[model samples]
Target: MDIEQLIALIDGFKQFPQIKRETTLFDIGSRGHFENPMTEVLSFFCNTTEVHGMNDLVISSIVSLIRQNAIYESLQYAQAHGKPQREVTTKNNKRIDLLLNSDEWVIAIESKVNHQQINPFDEYEAYVDSLIRTKKAVNKDNDLTDETEKQAVFVILSPDGKVDNVHLHPRWCGISFQQLVNEIKKRLQQHFFDAPFNKWYLVLKDFLLHLENLVNDEEQNSAQEEFVLTHLGEISQAWNLLKNTLQSVQQKAHTKLEQHPELNGILRSQKSSWFGLPTTILYSKDEMTEAVLFATGVPSVDIADDDPRNAGKHIFIQIHIQTDDEELELESIHESLANKAVNHWYSGGSKCFRWPVNELSIEGITKEFVSTFEAINNLSPLSLNK
Candidate 1:
């Protein structure tokens, strides 16, 4: 497909409703460490002893979803007894992301966010086994044979309910963030208004929203990848065409400025310092003062689709004055053109002005540059320099 056809397709896609992903508190506060904050929040909510006041509601909902019979039963048994801990150290000193421990049950949870399950599962398993052994020995000493036998549950938690290699650890169970989110949503729908602690309820709701956003973001990214891959050929052709068109328009503008009678004696073409676009420099006879005109929205296109200069359709002429003379009043020169120019600002000891032209044609660029140059030269200090 050609550039125009691709652009038309993009326009057609724009007719479809766009889903704007929300920026949750977790997104702002996580600061790029998603898993650590996620584990911390999960541990906070999972602890029944905490002030959340829902007691075992959150943990029980999560535990009930475990598919493995042994892990499910062990977690169920420990629902009231388990105390959630973050960064629990294993027997081999390897740290599990989150752990829930009780007298007779040990639940090891490894949290994953955009990372493979390459952790020391064996060490974590050993740690849980050691904990169970210690508890069993203590029970034996206390003659507590009537109590249920000790057990250990290993879980790998990720965005998707899948592990790297299920065969590697046959006993480990995989749970997804989406599953936990769904379970919590179901519980919240029934008990949200009746929740004892309104503050904690809001927090749980926010965390659930965060998880939902994460899952949605992943799904959208997958969709975007599929779309790009399916249209790679057309997209590649359009991109090359855009670059070529930008270069062509820039060359035409440069040629027009270089050949213009009004700017012939003073105009010199050079690469712009900003974005490396073509620049037309007009200097005074003494060469002590110069006006630099830069054309933007070319090789580097504007991101806004509605912008006239987007995709090299139009040109934005940016003019800035440079002078070696300290006595020249740059602000006064900028003030003179303020009414006629679209924008005027001061930066780095120079006064800059911007003018938007409707088209990228050579005549439009040349006409705008000559008028702006004259406006600057008409000022008292600049006119004296010329």
Candidate 2:
């Protein structure tokens, strides 16, 4: 269908529909106390760190309903600490609404609602440029010989028409609210076409008959209202069908991903024959810190030489929890132990010597962390097989 017809269909749902400038998004589904939803959606779209805001909720509700997606969150060892790198942010604001990160493969959505106006192309351009720069940088690091960009899906959540993919970049493509319902309609048509045409037509007719009952009640049947509500009723039916199809596909895809033979490797890796068993419990901060120390303690010792004779060797992980919250630190636990030790050491003398401790510089932490973890794995009884 033409863009105008799609825009008109969308306009029927909410205010701020068609604009002199097509970039203006309709404000339908606008009113609501949707802080949680927006925060969740913003975080989902950005795909890295957590985000929360009322505006984020508004954007998220629309994006989630129209686009079959959400932001992806991940946690990993970075610089010997759990540093949350927000994966994407849009550059449509004076201060970027999204941060595209070092690579364009991920997008980090950041927004400040205080701005008078947001530049339409700011996010689009930043996303493209981030991709280019990321490839070049990665290539530069890997030697100019391997400098090729990776492809990723491009998405825009707005009322505007899709950007000229050719004019912009090959990886860029988008859909608007106006286009979403039509896409669903097209899928219904495809399903009908694929079935025996007669059967499909009859099935579709039955579906519409059910829809007619929904809109045309025995009492309120004005001609104009019927004409309007009839389409709405059909849309509701189509939505239910689409939802089921999507859910089935999702279940199938997830099954493949989880049951794939390769996942066996990851499973084996995660649940290792270490000191005893896997330690993957969800714990509160205090409980988790205690658990990590307890878990780490469970790892049997390799070097037994502890007396003042040989090299007093000790292997321990530095619990580097890089928190933006200044209130928390690893030292509190250590210091508290030391304070308790003051009374015990006085009572017990040299029997319980303080533990040898060291801090790692953040600069070399990433390389060191990966290397140390690999070493820890090597020390693992599980690795003795290899």
Candidate 3:
């Protein structure tokens, strides 16, 4: 839709937070937790609109707007990009998504969604020394070449003459939507229309090797094998199908990331700035009222402050949690969720918060969460090196 329409849509949420007053002002028991009804409503409406086919993008946007950091990490380490080395995390059974390294480039990805296996141990580690180098020798600004250690932000754009110079790496050689498109375009120009017609042959060949491992795995079932075989075509076709799906997901995340521009956009106004923070909300009962009237789902929020029901601002936000596979929202699912939110608290225009609804986080770049980039950068395995 056009930008004005988009702005109007957001403004609609602002209006929703004030549709009704609470029946019991002084004590409505626990007003429950806080809920972010805007996205739920957007999600509900999106599922039913002419944009049905683009639902993933809309849903991802909703989730990404609420979960930027998680999206950033996912973009870096998704399996399609490279091999990943697993890490140790006490918070939960979190796993590193992917790891990619050449003599010149080393990347470690930490994904919050689609966390398949928690511990992808070393033989599980592809190319041991390479994994170590990708994880340990990344960019660190104050680095000295005395040891091979490098900084995390090092990119592959420029390479030092010395092959073993671990101190030298790409500075932000991270891929973006356009870069990916260019890469695919380059491959297509040279070989897509050629005899093999396997533009992804070189890249997907490796995945095919991995797929072979999958077939051989004792855990594999007949149904799974059949599914793989049925979808199998030229290696390039398979890769594209998967990449297209991911691209679709990635694009949707970008869209979702764009939703809360006023708040999330502020953290990342620059190219190199980092944006990272716990997705939050700040508003009054009127704001909450505005949110519910215009948004969808039973907005799930945590009550930050429970003061007098009649004379206090009720700030609300959606909770984010890192996990594998967010719940899918078919049109029906969104429709039901939207209806449910209305039926729950906002029935007579009363606003409320519910704890722990869907905890999803996106790893991204935005104005509000710009600080996150530095946080992740500091935590980056690349910067960890001396």
Candidate 4:
């Protein structure tokens, strides 16, 4: 597709309503590192003695979603033998994420976040097999009259109900986080007011919100995949064109930086760490300080207010000053450019300054870079060492 066609497609895409996911405590705490924390939370709620006060409700709802109906019935109707265990050791010392046991049933759960289902399923199955055999032996020794045989259920829980290596184990069953979330919601509706003042309820709510966010994110990604598949030809053409345009813009920016008279000796170009765009770097005399400028085609609304891109501004620039220089007063330099800068902060033992650019052209970017460079040099003539 042509540039105009690509622009029209982007414009049309932007017209769709934005659905913001609500931020939860789990979201903040996990920050995409969710596997262990999620397992702990699930184990807590699944335990009857936990403060969640919902007892077997959560675990029962989870079991109901499993493929084995007998196991769910046993766990839901009968009392679990003990508290749910986290990171339970298997026969080969492999740790299963969660383990729940009853007199007649043994359930082993392997939890996955973003990683593939590439665990020791054989070990897990063997562990469950050992447990079942031990249970049967004990029942026989005690001469228990109950005729029902012991059962083992192996579950692979992930964001999507998929097991990458299901062939490794015959008992492994797949369950989605979304399915568990839905089941828990259905069960919790009845117990919403059971403990009106319980803090664990709030914790459960937060955990559920986190799970919902993960499930929603997966669903949105699926929708995006569908969209890409539906418009593969147009999307491919547009992407190629966009990449070509960006390369052209980068070349122009580099030429402008090299051609600028004031930046004669100080100018160098490198790839930006932020967006991988071609960056124009102006080195100070000591070579410790650097003034970095780059142009991004990122849409305004996608940029954060405090971002180096200056949020809604079309141009992006940054100044880096080494902290080891005793003569360089970072605050003084920060203050001098405060009026022209969009934002300034300290990071990685270096002071950073961002200046606004209203124009979208290469010349506009070059002008801002030169202006900020001069401002810093004026503040501490010795800092840039230029």
User: lDDT: which is higher, 1 or 2?
Assistant: 1
List model 3 lDDT by residue over 139-233, tens digit each.
23212222234213211110111112332322222222223233333543454454344333433333223223322332334444564565354
Tens digits of per-residue lDDT, candidate 4, 124-192, equal: 877767766654332221332231455677887888877776555556778888888888888888886
Superposed on all Cα atoms, the candidates' RMSDs to the truth, in angstroms, are: 6.6, 30.6, 28.8, 6.4
Q: lDDT for each of the candidates? A: 0.63, 0.32, 0.28, 0.66
| TM-score per candidate, chains pooled | 0.72, 0.21, 0.19, 0.71
lDDT tens digits by residue: candidate 1, 164-225: 88778876888888998888888877775776556888788888888877777777777777
Candidate 4 or 3, higher lDDT: 4
Model 1, position 286, has a per-residue lDDT of 47
Pick out the ten consecutive residues of candidate 1 with the lowest summed lDDT.
Answer: 137-146
* 1-386: candidate 2 lDDT, tens digit per residue: 44565456556544422222211111225521122232233334333232311112222332333234322122111111111123333444332333232221333232222122234454555554565555443222222212133323344433333434435443434444344334434444655455544443343333233223322332233443654685675555544553443334333323332343433423221212223322221112232221111122222343233323212322222222223444433334443233221111211111222222233222222223222222222222122111
Judging by TM-score against the true structure, name the best candidate: 1
- lDDT (0-100) at residue 219 of candidate 4? 72
Instruction: Count backbone overlaps in model 2.
Output: 14
Give candidate 2's error at residue 225 in angstroms.
Answer: 18
Q: Which whole-number lDDT from 0 to 100 does residue 307 have in model 2?
A: 29
By summed lDDT, the worst window of 10 consecutive residues in model 2 runs over: 75-84
Q: Give the Cα-based TM-score of candidate 2 against the true structure.
A: 0.21
